[model samples]
Target chain A: MPVSTLTDPTLKDAHYLVDTGFEHGEMLTIVGKCEVDYDGRASSHLAPGERLVILKPDGTLLVHRNKQRKPVNWQPPGSTHSARLDDNRLIVESVRSSPHEELEITFQTVVQVSRLEVDDVSDLELEGSEEDLRQRILADPDILETGFNAMATERETSAGPIDIYGQDADGTPIAVELKRRRVGPDAVSQLNRYVEALERNRPSKSVRGILVAPSVTERAKQLLTSEGLEFVSLTPEQEDISQPIGFSEDADK
Target chain B: MPVSTLTDPTLKDAHYLVDTGFEHGEMLTIVGKCEVDYDGRASSHLAPGERLVILKPDGTLLVHRNKQRKPVNWQPPGSTHSARLDDNRLIVESVRSSPHEELEITFQTVVQVSRLEVDDVSDLELEGSEEDLRQRILADPDILETGFNAMATERETSAGPIDIYGQDADGTPIAVELKRRRVGPDAVSQLNRYVEALERNRPSKSVRGILVAPSVTERAKQLLTSEGLEFVSLTPEQEDISQPIGFSEDADK
Candidate 1:
């Protein structure tokens, strides 16, 4: 196993490309998307419907399905007066410009019930198990799963054999571990070992691993790049993975 | 009854002094007072220990009575979270801030039922006789007595007696006619006349009115303002005055 770390500023363009959208002021809609590329793309390779979002504007926010010509509905991020920003022009434009990816509607549930707090796995009245979680991942046609505990093998670490894992719609396996509490060279070594073990042992499907954390040490990011493992981090508002691409039309003005 | 209108914005401002809390980005807490001039002070104001709120932050909203500083103890607005903002905050910040008024806690039911379709409230529904409406208003302390609505009497141009009525809260009132269509400058003029009559009738009380319309004209805002009758062009959100406010703490970086 090897160890490495990296920081966002050192990366080309300061951040890796996760998605693209059409931004008119605070209103943003995913006009198009590039494949989740760890490396930055050249301007010549810019796809017709793809554009970067670099700001968060104040206005209406509407979410709708693919190729829809008008925003189905709207909600103000932080105010009363629900329909304050419902402009017809913006709704039409967003629908006209929306990309092909099916809008992923995250099922949000806040559990304040003490019996079902975050760490209550044993008490969890599960419909299934860890393997069931993976099976559910595989069963999804759209395959956008989030907030599930990762499955790791007994490849071992200073803490434990418990590592992070992800499964795609077709059962492609990708493992990820967080160095959330601390950042150092050893994180790279640790993630690399997990990746190597997963690859060599050959879990039930195609396997890859990602090292995800808030901010990676420079050395770790550099070495991971050299070793070809994915590295991911947050950029302010985008930290909420479930938030859709853009602001609503009313939000723009 | 002599008829005149309130054309001065300053008087309107004074009429709406207690309502500045509902203004943009401002907060209002109804610290109940037995008496005061409205710097939020009181000669005999006693704290009722309940707080209600209306907040608008950058990307977050808060419209709940956050009592005891714990999640479970929270209640939706109007019930625990009153329409007033200060009452909501007092339940949490009472330990530090001095009491300014004796706040009251009135309850209203707020249920979450989506896709509310706004249709016209029929003229029949909108057309209860003046006596019936006055009786209905007086019967519900939760209505007029909660300081949401205040009634004023004045002379009308076409109709002899007019009721100058404010909205549910301490907002601008309307020159309501039990049966009227094609609300014109006369309806406008009559509303102004009532405002004057009401002021003369009750020299101590502030007077305002809305001329209820099946549809208000494009020039209605200007016409109403010129005549000194504050009218509300009811939006769908305003119409759903009973909707409960919900709170969710989203983790943002």
Candidate 2:
């Protein structure tokens, strides 16, 4: 693997694209001061200042401040990364197709740039949680097999947070409420409020509500039917894989 | 720089320490299921499951689950890392000295291991908000420079969370309440609650209250003095470094 470490004075704008290969698992780390504005799920602003920007081979982009271990802002893996120079500033954008997340960072000045040809991968370790399961459903659209195209996840309504906002195959608006456990009547009531709020705010027509959980009780199903809502049960592949295999003292033999 | 990608079928325990050099700018990523127990700062447990683990050259150890982009647990840089085989598991440990944080991960199985020799870094970019500023004070006691040793951050009491809990050089128990903006009387009231709660809970003697903020007004300072509390003002290093440089239309020309 080859490594190139260059100072800002020696770096050309084309180096972000032509000089390094990022898709082949190459890594790029840039240290600079930047003005960052994120307009995706939410809008945030970072005044121009000294910041560390990392572009990884796996398509993870992180914007870090000197004080915290965690990046102040970042786009998770599977986001598409593009680096381009605009006028006097270098612009890097990371876009995610599923959740429609986009992070744009504009570097006012470049202090340094280093690119590494990364080849060491039997496979990079990737982990996921229930949120990932929701993302998978959004990305595939067919995971539900219910012909639902998830429009959004964790979209906020006046009433509360709608776990999944989408439309049926016929383009009817659908709101989904997610739960890691077996949902009950309280969950139904919460979903009812969210659906009511959505419909009240967008009152051109009625909106549909859907309760999503690993399992839904019969009582909850009755409530859902009474409320004119739907249900979707998801069993993540890792759910079964993550269950611990029981061991006993006798098993040591 | 040499890169090594190996599978456990051909990996020996000694190779974790021998086959690759991690002290130099190298990154080691291990993927497998592990039972993890973290007993520093706070105690957390992770049942056996597939997980991603990363060990950086700077001694930052991260244990990741499949749910979120962030690691489930991690230790900051400047920690010591050691990997070895214990019983039927692979044990990885990272130990940090200041404020003392330790993370231990036991890998139940090994799916893949990759070591990368990295050569790229000019400077690190750092950013942090008020929360980050408070965390930095908690993590490094020496930052106070007031002979105050921060014991724990955000320690919960009946009233609320104490920003910093520690002892002064004279061995007096101190409870700190942090605010990023100018201190006000409401902050004093909150700090008074936290201090009173701490003293009530551990009541052999009284625990003194301290107000920490970026800047304190004269009225707030008078209130603190009247309440028998101390005040510490901080202007984070990152704060000055992060201020945006002015660029006018003339400059654009």
Best by DockQ: 2
User: How many clashes (backbone atoms < 3 Å, residues ≥3 apart in a chain or on different chains) does model 2 have?
Assistant: 10
Consecutive 10-residue window with the lowest summed lDDT within model 1 chain A: A111-120
Q: Candidate 2: which stretches are off by over 4 Å?
A: A1-68, A76-92, A95-253, B7-14, B17-19, B23-25, B98-101, B123-253
State the lDDT of candidate 1 residue by residue for A1-253, as single tens digits.
0101111122221121111111212222221122111111111111112111111122223322121222222322321111111221111111111211111111111000000001101111122223333343334312323533344434353223534465644566766555433344456555655565566566554566666555777655665665577765521112234756576768878
Q: Pick the candidate with the highest lDDT.
A: 2
**What digit string (tens of lDDT, one per residue) describes model 1 on residues B15-93?**
2432332333222212111111111121122222222222211111121221111111112222211133242221211
Q: How many backbone clashes does candidate 1 have?
A: 45
Model 2, span A150-251: residue lDDT tens = 877788886657888888888888887777557666677678767877887889978988776778887667767867988878743334545456756587
Backbone clashes in model 2, listed as residue pairs: A52-B125, A65-B126, A65-B127, A66-B126, A66-B127, A127-B66, A128-B66, A128-B67, A129-B66, A129-B67
lDDT of 2 at B88: 66
